[model samples]
Target: MKILFHVLVSSILLVSCGSSKQLNENKNSLTKEINKIYQENVFNGFAVSIVDEKGTLYQQGYGFADISTKKEYTNNTIQNIASVSKTLVGVALQKAQELGKINLDDPIEKYLDFNVSNPNFPNEKITIRQLSNHTSSIVDNEFYLSKNYYLKSNQDLTNVKLNFDEEQVFNPSDMKISLQKFLKNTLEKNGKWNKDSFSKNAPGTIYEYSNIGTTLAAYIVEKATGETFQNFTKKNILQPLKMDQSGWTFQDVDFSKFSKLYESPTTLLPFYEMVTYPDGGFITSVNDLSKFLSELIKGYNGNGKILSKESYKEYFHPQLSATNFIERNTQNPYNESYNVGNFIGYGYTGFIGHTGGDPGVLSMMFFDPKTNIGRIMILNTNFSNKKGNDAFYGIWNILEKYQDKLIK
Candidate 1:
């Protein structure tokens, strides 16, 4: 193992010469495969970064960041990372633990002013770990706060789908004023689905992938430290790690460097106005996100910029049963991803990542704790049910096909 204590001392990166030739060959192969995929698919733009414990091995971008001005997308072009932000929240809580603010295994109610409990399982108290791993048994409608809710059975790991009427759409403006405020309403007593939202299944037993579960976790961090999630993450994770190109809001980023989003190759999508910001509101660049990913790789190797080595292991540990991850879940596809090996494989981690998708976005961020290697990818366009071998999730498949080849 190439354990470098010097990385702990400074952010100055080291590159090993062992696989220089193969690394170049892998890069060439990846570029060709990626080009072929993007050429055949209708994508506005995409950015990707690959890294190990030492530093970034490859970072690149394709297509146009701003089609109006014909600006070519590059590594610094920022985009809203969608649900991948959950991992950021997970890491923040780890920092909160280091600061003696909260414990992952402790009941989440202890951190909040409001009582958070599943009414069906009233006596059961949810823990921070469950929330992080999506086994909290708190079902999320991710839209309306009432009705359409179900309990997570230990047997189900896929995200639960509710029977919402086609016309019964939701508006972000109608939700809570802030993410913290939203959690208070959604997870507390007398709240919209206070009773219905809580599952009969006990907390820490079932794996129901939830955006609300993670948003609540972020709120717990805020309650424990008396600070907003954005400010806390900026102060502790982003700034400390020197991910200067990343932020939780518009004010933290350079508008000129931002990539315009799209619903399709030619269709446009507005920038995000987040009601549940903590769940999917992080905006960052391949360069900045690479720095964060690099630190995580370092953390798994027992050396990190912000989170301790132990925290890294704990945060990335699998939260579901082996069978739950042996086959990928289509419903909660954002929280985990697998290689294109007939069956999707988590390769030792189902919680280390949070893939993202919306009108015009398809993104992924994942790392293997054992090998200290990971990837961050974002696309400004969303393609569905395309007809080909590498149609929709080509980026993931590409990385999976060459993961070992690219990792030095």
Candidate 2:
């Protein structure tokens, strides 16, 4: 019996050693392939993370976070994630519901002082659920793009080259407006910025992607919980997940670690903030976001920490049917608009997560339910042509090809 026990122990040790060796080999190969793509890419800086339900499997950052200063972009480098921030809104909404502060079905008017009636459908009462699913009939008008962005206060813009699209204008810092005022002006029936702000479809009938609509949902969470949306999320989600490096605004994070966003490989953009920040404007590092993604995967599997299982169910539930969309994106597997959960997103291929794009930023985060493995990629430079697009997806595909090999 003693001889048999010794043999079994030796066998187990050998197997463990073999597994570790194989994992290291896979990691080396993945790094090599991803580095190859980065060498030929046009973007200034970017980061990628591969995660499972438990934690990060592999993560790395490449290129220059600040090209002028030669600061390398690392896993700890932080930047705004654009619309991926909506996923946090989704999580915050569920947490609010779990605390009994609000109900998903309640009319938004119950919490808001301003009247936000869609003139096209005046009698319809838009519920929180409708706003969460992008079917609230609210539309992002011209003002959303032209008037919402402001240069960060005290920035020296004298030498900064402000290259942007026509709709992407940067207002002076003094021109900034509060989140409530911005939403009221855009969504209220009789406000200065209201112009074609509501679609012809009634609430809960058509799917229209609205940044302003998302910010409204977050604002509702604030009114219901009697707390600011930023503070509410910090206490609940960020704290619980130990995402100490992430926040909704510059005030919440270390500004020194923030990356300088690029218009092109050679052109840099002036730092700016959005008035409708809840829709997009989550600033975090890839390392911190990996923790959040892991939590989401755990939540999907009925083991989340921040929100109850019941709340997670509603948060991930597909709220839109085929009738909700006039045309669906059947091509891109990373496209989040294929369908939507509370504020979460479903791809055409059944992956669940969100994608976000803003001036000088592009980010994708998604996980497969069957495999429970996820991939995230965040770029500081904007991609406009086919070459940049191909290179971006090329790095993503490399991650997908090797993610399972890292699993043990």
Candidate 3:
């Protein structure tokens, strides 16, 4: 009996040790794959996080915060997330509902002091829901895409520089209009695009991705809460997440810890600012963003620390798809795979997130509700480098291709 007992215990110990060894091996493999990507020198810097319902499973920052300074980028290095900033605004809008600030079904013009209506469909009002879903019929015109507007922005105060070639481009000090003023010109009846910006279709009739729609969400937050979008998001979201290093404007980030936007492994790009800060203006770290991503993943499974169950549903439920009520489904002039969801876009079947890009920056963040898995990838490089990974655009394109096998 004593001999048998010893053998049983030894066998159990061996099995336990073997299991641990295999788990470590798997984790090491994933890390090695990520390291391989980092060593490729595709972009100057990147901060990534992979998570599930429980919490962050992996996170690392590669390269330098500023190559000139030789400062290393860590899991905590904060940088602009581009349009991925919209997801943060999505959750904030849900919180606004919890705070009894506004309803999703409310007409957006009800919150804005200015009138924003589709000139072609003047009788049909654009609701907060339509804006969140990218079905508001608003379009981006020359002004939204013009460099001259940004040249005149407050961002010009700092002799901003940009690199796009192993490339670079400097920020121009040239705009006379504030964000609100620009919105007035584009959204109000007398505004330049009031007639042109509105698509031929009626409001909420189709999915026309708009930066204007996302920024309006932040504006509504301000209009309803009577606080600027930055302050309100800080007090309610950043503070609670203990993301002290995150903020909207340049003044909010600690330059010592901030990563320079880059086009190549060595090139740096000057920053751009927008009065429409809510759309894609946030600067955040992997650690801080992971905290928020976990909350979102948790919400995907039903409840989250920040958003309640009903609010979560309202924020994530898919609103339009080819099989659904969309009148017209164009090839998404930018990226056809891009689809619309409630206040955000669907990355995949179970994903509700957003993508972002600028002259030299590209980013993606999305969470799968069914698997409770989430991934975030940001490259100081834009979509121009579309050669490898079988014509994939950036780091995100490759990461997403191997998301499951590489992340787990």
Candidate 1: clashing pairs of residues = 334-355
TM-score of each: 0.79, 0.98, 0.83
> On a 0 to 1 TM-score scale, where does candidate 2 land against the true structure?
0.98
Global lDDT of each candidate: 0.69, 0.92, 0.70
Off by over 4 Å in 2: none
How would you order the candidates by TM-score, starting with the best?
A: 2, 3, 1
Q: Could you tell which candidate, 1 or 3, scores higher by lDDT?
A: 3
The predictions' CA RMSDs to the true structure, in order, are 9.5, 1.1, 4.4
Error of 2 at 379 (Å): 0.9
lDDT of 1 by residue, 1-408 (tens): 246666644443333444577788889998888878778747778888777778887888987897767898899998788777777887888889989999888998798888888877888878888787666888775343332122212222223222222532223333326565566667777776454566667887755667788778888888899998889999999999788888877778886897877666666655544566677778889888888878877876778878777777676554566443334555543346432110112433332555776545677777765566778788887665554325546776686677678755
Ranking of all predicted structures according to lDDT, beginning with the best and ending with the worst: 2, 3, 1
Going through the candidates in order, what is the number of backbone clashes in each?
1, 0, 14
lDDT string for model 3 (24-83, tens) is: 666566566666766766666677777777777767777777767777779887777878
